[model samples]
Every structure is written in C-alpha cells, then in structure tokens.
Target: MMHRTQRQIRTDEPSVAAEALSVTHVTHGLTVEDSGEGFAFEERVRGTALLSLESTRCTGTLSGAVEPGRAMMIVWVKSGSAVVDDNPVKVGRPVLYRQDPQRFRWVDVQHDVLRIDRTIVEQVAAERGDWAPGPLEFRPRHVPEGAPLAAWWLMVRSVAQEVLQGPADVPVERERELARFAAGGLLTAIPHWPVGQHEPVMASTARFARAETFLLDHATEQITVNDVAEAAGLSVRGVQAAFQRHHGITPTMYLRRIRLLLAREQLEAGDDRSVAEIARATGFAHLGRFAGSYRQEFGELPRQTALAARE
Candidate 1:
C-alpha cells in the first residue's frame, strides 16, 4: 500500500501530519507538533513525488535524526517563514531540504504555507545526459532560481495531473516514463558538474542485441560493470549509456532480468538443485531479494516456480 499510485487526502487534524507524510524524517522518528489553533493539510502523491499544501493555526517543528534517500526535497514557503533544521526558511523562497540527506536534521513549518516536497534522482534518466550518475545535490540556496526551476515545477505538475488524475491503474511503462522524466528534469535543472545534458541517444537494437547475447552467455557468472564494459569493448559509462539509450534499462538491470529468467528456467526445469543453490548458481547472491524480485517479475517465487514445475 505504501507504493499507492496516487492519493489525495485532506485532513483538518494537525495530529495527522506525521502519519500522513511518510517522509524519511517523520517516519524515522521525527517528532512534529503544530499549535492546535486551526489546521488544514492536503497531501497529493504521484509515483515519485509528494506534494503537500499545509496551513496550520501555528508553525510545526520536524525534529529528529534525518533519514537518508531524500535525493531532493524542494520546499517553497508560500507564506510565513519556516525554520528548517537550524536555519531560517524565508517566505517566498524555495528551501531545499537535502543536498545531503544524512546531514539534514529537521524542519519547522510555519502556518499558512503551501509547500512542495519533490523526491528526485537523476540516475534513472538513462542516456539522456552525459553527467556522471550520482546523487543529485544542490548548493545551499534560499530561492532556487532560473528557467529550469520553473520548468521542472511546471512539468511535475503536468505529469502529476496526468498520472494522478487519470483513470485507475496507470500502466507500468507510463509510470516508468514518469520517473524518467522527473529525474531527467531535475538533472537538467540543477547545477552540476559534467555540465549540460546530451540529447537522448536513439536506441540501437543491434547494440542491445549484441549486449544481450553477451549477457545471456555469461548470465550465470558474477559479472561486474567492468566485466560488461570490457566485453562490450566500451568504458563502464559507455556501456551504461548504450544500454540505457537502446533498451531503456541499465546493463545491470538487463543482467539481473536475464539472470532472473535463467533462474526461473532452471526452476521450471525441475533441476535437482534447491532454490537457494539455484539462486546462488545463477549469480543471485542475496536469496531473499532474488526471491522477492522473482515473485515481482514472474508473479511467483522460486519455490512456487519449482512447485508449479513438479505439478
């Protein structure tokens, strides 16, 4: 239920903010308190971002140990000033909660504020950019400026409306595209090294086919990025860029999928090996995560696959 595609919840209770927003800080044990004068909170969540519009009788404080994976939390203070962690969050200025999620502590939300909390990552954008993939961090700035900021906000709003407002059960490919666009926009908007996005490379079916052949051949081995790169006669980044461009998937993801298929094939063949042994033999080192992934992809775990084969 945590990965609900879209949700719109409105509550007048200030007590529900913490539970309503399953953000890292709050869920990781941040204590939040709003002065109980009059409060209205609305949360709109799409696949990759959580947008909140909160108006409280008084300001609320988010205090506790910071949880990680806050790739980006762009906070725009619609009205009164907020105090984020130890710093003052000025009105009309966008406060970025994390360039580093681990270093961030807390947020004190002022009354009568409409805020935006964008969950961001640039890595998923695939081969659209030349920038080295890593955590998309921003410099400490009160108001995030320029055309990209406005453009990104606008795009997110448009995508949210389309995805969240659309009929039930948005398709999986559309969801994946949404994630790629959001992350791609962030990468375009933010100031980062290896500057500027290269135009998206057209997918090369031949290249992907070649890579696929190599991967299928060595699917049972513990291959690293370097190995793939070397076999492909390209640099690591080049391999990633190529796979991402052509297949809309990274080499690692492609390898994992192939391995999962191999594992399933083995299971369905009713091989004498146990599930754990088969998983290990197929280069799925973490048995639990492998089973989880198998269930997700094949709609049955490895054990179930074996059972179905026997039956």
Candidate 2:
C-alpha cells in the first residue's frame, strides 16, 4: 500500500536541523554549517515501496555531503539556488544525482526529489528489451530542459498530487502501477540509452487482439502495462507499439476508455451507488477527474446519468 509521511523542524540549533535532515533524507555524514542563528526545514514524502516523492524546503543555508545510495535520485530546484558537486544548479532545471558522492549547498531552497529503486529502472529497461548484462547507467546530469523540463515537472506534480495523495489503502496493484509510472517518466525525461541502439519491434495483429481482450476482461482491476505485455506475449514496448499502430492510442488509454464505459453503464443502470463509489468501482481513484473524464466522454456528468436513470 502507498503511504504518506511528513516532518518539520524549526530550531535555532544546527544539530537539531541536521538530525532532521539526516533522518528524513536517509543520508549519512550530514553536517550543518553556519545556519545563521536559526533554520526551518520541512519535508513531505509519499510513496510505495518502489518509489518515493519528497518535497523539501529549507529556509537557511545548509551544506553537507550525501553518499550515493541504491536508489536513483532526481531533483528539481523549484525556488532557490544550489551547488552539487561544485556544479551550479539553476532554478527549474532537473538534476539526476546518483552513483557518486555529492557535496551540496542550498540557500533558502525548495525542491522536489524523486527516489526510484534501481531495480525498477532495470526492470523497465528489460521490458523495453534495452537491458544489457551489466547494471543500467544513466547520464548523471543529463536532464530535460526548456519545454521538456516543464512537461516533466508537470508529470511529477500530477503524480504527486493526484495519484500519491489518494487513500492510504490503495491496492498493491495500483501502487505497482504508480511505481512504473514514475520509472517510465524518469526514463523518458532522462537520457539513458543510445538513440538508435534498439530497433522497434513490430507487433502483430493477433498480439494486439490478445492485449485488447485482456484489457476488456480486466478493465475494472488495477493492472500495469507489464500485465498487458505478458498477456499479449510481447515486450512492454511491443505492446505499446501494438496499441499505437492499431488504435492510435496507448494501452493505458485503451484501458481507461474501457473503465469509463463500465462506469457509465453502472451510472445509467441506477446501481444505487454514489458517483464516487461508481468511480472507484470502475477503477477511477480521483472523483473530480472521474467526473471530468465522464463528462468529456459522454457529454454529461455521472450524476446527470444517474439522475436520468432514476427519473
């Protein structure tokens, strides 16, 4: 299940602030230097076992060395400036920090950090048939810039607000999907592989048919692209290509369409359930989004459909 945790520290003592930072960040050898009398630190972290979204803000100068851990760390400085490993990081620029010890200094900085397990990255690489024998390596500092950077930030915030903020008892399957979503976004936003190293595999019509069947059969359940690929006997990339070539949409979109249809049916049938209930029953976790998408697809809100059915 996904979980959310928060911590805040406001104190004049540097030791207190340093302790908070080390505990929250799971860092080692963290030291606070010259806090200038007092500091405020706060962090909100929400994630499952595979990925974590951390938003941290510090209202004073903090400097320390962070040892490289097993997870891949991606950070975006939202407001203030920082220097990592003597490389100046600008506001709104994404930074991939991993595999090496990092010396950092932050002055009144607000940043969002994504920690994804290395195993998840490797699994994604394997799904794309891009995995080599050795450990997967990503360019340490090559993150998206300009419009791509904006898009990546948008994706991160969306997942943080929409998906990760859902009910704590969210199914394990949904958590897995969430992890994969984060991993996929990171892989897309960063440069990990050679541009033309892997050729795209063409998926046959039969494979697409099988995938479609699997989606229809399991539309209301939480499932990942990996499940679809397995059902279609194709790689994840292969299943995605199959969907795009056949229906001009991705497998996830197709599955969402099916769920929307199911939700509409339940609404129109006067199932005696609330709109939110029907939404969750049909695999929509966020009610506002469910209502919006329902309206867009059917030209009426879910309540309108149920009201008409009752009349």
Candidate 3:
C-alpha cells in the first residue's frame, strides 16, 4: 500500500465528530479552541503514526480510542497543569502517556497540546516486550527532563510537523524506526515497583500482581480498595503503595479507568443502547455521577458519545 499523508479539517459545529471515520486514512494535526470544557475525536488507526496536539487555551479531560491493534504516545506540549486521576501534572515539558488497550484513560489535559502516534509505536514496543503489556495508562515515572528518550520524542515531534507540511522522502520503515527510538526511550523511563535500595520484595510484588489481575477480571462489578486488598491477601496500604510505585496512581483510579473504557466501547460502537443504559451496563449506578465522570474522563459528555455513534 502507498504511504498515506495526514490530513486536517476544521469544524465549528458541536456535531462534526461523525466525520472522523470517513477519512479512512491516518491523521496528525493540532486543535486550537476556547472552551472551559474540551472535546474528543476518534478514528481507526493501524501501523505507526504520530500526532502532536497543543492547545493555547483550555483545560479538560481526554478519553477514547483504546483498543487492540492500536497504541498511542501522548505528550503535553503546552505550559500549564492538568490533573490525572485527580493528581496535578505541571506542564511545559512533555508528559509521556500510553493508552491502555483494555481501558480508557481520564487524562487531565491543560491548555497544552498533545502529540499522538499509533501502530508504528506498537511495532517498536514489540521488540521491547513492554508494548504487549497493553496501552500504558499512567505517566511514566520520573525521568529527568532531558533524558535521551525525551530528546528523541522532541525530534519526532518536529518530524511529524514537517510531514504535515508536505510529503517527505523518508521510507515508512524509517518513520517506524524513529517511532521505535521514541518508544524505547519512553519504556526505559517507566518506574519499576519495589525499586529501592534493597532487593525486590516478594511480599510487595505478589500483592500488587494479584490485585492487578483481580481488577482486570472484575472491572464490570462494583469494587473497592478493601475488596481488592482482601482478594490479594494484602493490606490496603500495601496495594496502594504497589500501584503508586509502578503506575504512579492509586488502585481506585485504575479501576475507574477500566469502567470508563467499557463505557467508551459501547459509546463508540453506536449500538442501540441508550447513554443511561450504557452507564448502568458499565457498572456506573448513578446517572449524574456517571455523566460527570464520563465527561471528566472524556472531554465530552455521555450524550455526545451516543450522538457521535449515530453519525
């Protein structure tokens, strides 16, 4: 197949999300707008692709596009702050994010823009074995600002913008390699659990692994930290520390990611299901709370998701 060039189209109507899929081809672009509340866009993507989006104004949540055969690396390109799972991320330097294939993320995006690339990253990650863990949900733990991986990503961002200007002579494999280099730097920066001055703690590792497995298997049910800790034979504190050390978030936030992901699948499929029905089906029992979280997790509300589905 011939290499496809990225395309950009602007719309002012709240109802234009329906047009995203007709393009068929992959995309990379920037969105500039003023809305206390942000927005969302979804498209099918395969192969390695890169997208950089930086906002000059606005702060909101971003959700959607989590599925198998897809991978993304998102960076914060603006100078400001956004709350991830209620945790604030200071902006300016880019934040590396991987989408969880089995779940959706409630990314706190500030006025800063985001850069995203799809399949090419998966291929590079395949070599590293870290890619198969599924899309990463949390920011990779603290790596110094000028790390090699960070520098490489900065380069990729420049190249992505160039490709947008005009078709380049670079081969697809070369583009793929560039993506690989970026992914390599990112994976290396992820913080490992139980990393301390001592050896890996068996008690901590086992507890964390068990809790993670339980959450993945039972995301559809109403669950709590106590339940997860009991199931994993660990104390609540232990489970919390494990997630914090490895993923940089609490267990509850992780579960919310799973719940939102299920809701997104229904919303994107454009099924006959109602928005409220989707909320309940996904284990969100309260309509108001569900709508608020859904909106916070994604830049748009549940109704918008259903509306996009109909399109």
Indicate whether candidate 2 or candidate 3 has the larger lDDT. Answer: 2
Q: In model 3, where do residues sit more than 4 Å from their true spots?
A: 1-205
User: How good is model 1 by TM-score?
Assistant: 0.45
lDDT of 1 at 91: 56
Better of 1 and 2 by lDDT: 2
Best by TM-score: 2
lDDT string for model 3 (168-211, tens) is: 44576555544554553344334222222232222123455557
Give the Å error, residue 38, model 3: 35
| Clashing residue pairs found in predicted model 1 | none
Q: Write the per-residue lDDT of candidate 1 for residues 6-75, one digit (tens) a residue.
A: 4556666656766665542333455555545555555554443332223332244544544334434455
Top-lDDT structure, candidate number: 2
> 139-213, model 2: which lDDT tens digit per residue?
556656432343355347557864455776666666666666566557645655533344333211346545755
Task: Sort the candidates on lDDT, descending order.
Answer: 2, 1, 3
Extract clashing residue pairs from model 2: none
lDDT, candidates in the order shown = 0.53, 0.69, 0.50
| Stretches of candidate 2 exceeding 4 Å from the true structure | 2-12, 34-38, 132-134, 194-311
